[model samples]
Target: MVSLRLRLGKAGRRWLLLFHRWAGIVAGLFFALWIGSGLVMLYVPFPTLTETERLARLTPIAWDQVAVAPDDALRAGGAVGLPAAFNLEMRGGEAVYRIAGRDGNRATVSARTGARLGPLTPEGALRLATEGLPDGRVEPVERDQWTVTARYDPLRPFLKVALGDPAGTELYVSQVTGEIALDTTQFERAWNWVGAVTHWIYLTPLRARPELWRTILLWLSGFAALGALSGLVVGIWRLRLRRRYAGGSVTPYRGIARWHHLFGLAGGIGLSTFIVSGWISMNPYRWFSSNAAPAEIRAAYAGAPPPLGLDAATLRGFAEPGTRGLRFVAIGGSWWIVTDGLAGTQGRRAADGLPLTVDAITSAAARAVPGGALRAVEPLAGFDTYWYPHGADPRPLPVLRLRFDDPAAIWLHVDPRDGAILQRLDLSGRINRWLFDGAHRLDLPGLTGSRRLHDAAQWILNLLAAGIAVTGLVAGWRRLRRTLSA
Candidate 1:
């Protein structure tokens, strides 16, 4: 042992130092690129328009005045110039008919008012569709009712909606007024095309497989993380370099190199963790569902009541105090509120009374989860724990939304009349939940920062990996050069 230690003294240290330096230098650029791209992805929101935004874009028509049958409306509008894939919708309140074309063209006409709202032009529709917006056309194939044939543009394809046969369409007749408050066929062919493009990233001219891209990037990131870990080990082995050059007298390049080493040593583990987690997130389905069985999912759903249909207007009244600027209302047997908060935080709420206890089948009035429960679960159930490694259970307690300090929380309200638990899911978890969720969501502001940091770490790690890969190359090159000189 003594002899081994002696042998490993100065010579071993020097070799280790060399290893660390070269490894970092080699992997630096690739790490930087990954970090930079990640940062951009973090902040860039997905291409989707909110319901209110959709409403604002089109004109409002009254609920009472739909004059023409859907088929008649299509006939009145003239020959169907666009392809088969189009969609239509009827907006409530004002009997407004909305026609959406495949490419994202949209036109709104008042059913009662008989006034034409502005049309979403083909160019505008194209832009929206390319960004993954929904576009389709609607026509009344029958009398008194409309048959909305939603089409997918062959130009841009999407996984959500198959091409040729568009996604499903909805029909609504005004309950108070006899008029068809909503019509789906008013938009032109150009509009439908644009909408189709907006709804799918794959439909874009430069289509790339999202899942495949995500998988590739994740694997690349994993490799980069490994490189980083190795570099860190190498860096630690060479601590003397920093001590030897601590004084200001050291050369400028040496000083910079020393600082780099210092940073890498301190930040390496953290960088590795982030990168690994990010890779895991990219393929959450694979990781999370690996351990989750259909049995388990069915079991979870079994205790729950059958889904219910909710009244959006009623839900709005209940959710108003907790949420503001309601964006979308998801109605089942219960209602969910998607809203912006008074603070910068986004909000979500369900009707008061969702029974959380596993055995209970009935819902109580919707109440916020108590503070103590939130405090307890926040650390465990937060995104940091729940979102990664796929199936790992970071068991969290049920907490109510209004009471939790989190900026966002899903509210599951159970209507007293029915046993359904209303589920309201926000893009972000509650404010407290944001700490974990924000890091994962590319929609949040920190997405860019987190991605950048991860990328930078990856680049540094990749350089280190390259160094390892080229170790033999380096040795060969030096030996060849020496032979040439001799």
Candidate 2:
């Protein structure tokens, strides 16, 4: 053991030190960028216009114009199979039924004429935009790369309308559904260029293709992880548990090199942890596959519909005060009425506005997917891998976790709160929770409780990581200066 230690300390470490030094010099700027951007991320997340914000901009419900019911609109639009979900919303002062099919197709049916809204012409798309935003001046619409990402999927070929507001709000109205799909303010756009865009290395040219973007980020972060690992090895080798250099300073290296060693020792594990976890997020091997049985959801999860004769007047009684819009979801073979409220989560069946029971729900969920058998109906009161809202998904819980028996290993998260299917996690998605979301965010159950606590821990860890990167930057600059002068 003594000889082994001596051999490593005397000769083995020198080569490692050399390699680490060169690698750090080459990749140090990116490390500093990742750390600095990561700190910014702890406070200011990637920009998004929340659903609440979008609803606030809408005109109130015009009950006088409502001629057709939600079910009538679906049939009018020639909806294929039972919709996995549907949003009963008003577009342009007219009631419109936006139906999302189980097969990922979407269409808007006019509640007034019961006519399916056809493909949007430039004039028609502009008319829709103007109706939604009366106060703001508009730019001509473009159906281009803006809404081509996964974030805006199922809501595309959008009519991009830039509002001349102080915040530079740009609203992307979905051409098919005639609904505002995404709203981005000026601050979100500007800050994101520095924060999420740079941090994730998400350039549009590269990120336009999902597979290509994931691959690029995976390879880049992979190399960065390599750089961090080598630095950790060298940092530990030069660490001073007890002994010091000639002047009795704790750090054997001088100046920036000393700071690099000091902070690297302090936060090397954190640096390595973040890089590797970030790489894992891309799912390079495609382990967890989304095994959602949509056909099963239509068969088992759907309830027998209320007669189409039920009209708009019936819905009037259900609307509460300050309600921007209403969405009716059919889950577990029952119709649940959902509307936005100040307190949030106002739910009851359409038949009698009665509170839902658990027994009725679980029975419907059991039929949602077939194969092996029923697993535990788990409640996600706390953050786990998949159910927690990492971004702008406002499907509030108390949510239900439905497990299945098939070899694909399916887990369906149903929202009992509003009878909405919140998330469908297959085998790959379950693993994704631990590997990507778990590692990248470090939201270990033991480490986190409330979101406030999670943010605090994330801040402390990220700050230490920033220190490591900054020290490396300083050292690399000095080293480069010496080399250039020599």
**Whose TM-score is greatest here?**
2
lDDT of 2 at 233: 82
How many backbone clashes can be found in candidate 1?
A: 84
Model 1, global lDDT: 0.36
lDDT of 1 by residue, 1-486 (tens): 988888888677676656544444444454554444433333332233333344343332222344533333333333143311112233423344344433354344444444555433333333322234345333222222121122222112111211122433232222221122232322322343333322221233233345565565666666655666665776565566454544632322243454555555556655555555555555545533222213322223223222223332343343333332332222222323333333322323344534223222222222233221222122122233223211112222332221123343333323222222333333332332333233333224433335465445445644543333344234434545787799
Clashes of 2: 3
The residue-by-residue lDDT of candidate 2 on 1-486, one tens digit each, is: 999999987776787777778778887788778766765665566655576767766666666767788778878767786676666666877777778877788888877788898866555656666544555544433333344467567776777676666678777777777777777778777776677777887777776777888887878788888888988888887776678667777667877778888888888888888888887776668665653446656567776665434577888777776665677767665677778654475666778888666666788777777665667788777656465555434446677887888777777777776766666788777777677666677767755446687777777777878888777877878888999999
lDDT of each: 0.36, 0.71
TM-score of each: 0.40, 0.83
lDDT of 2: 0.71
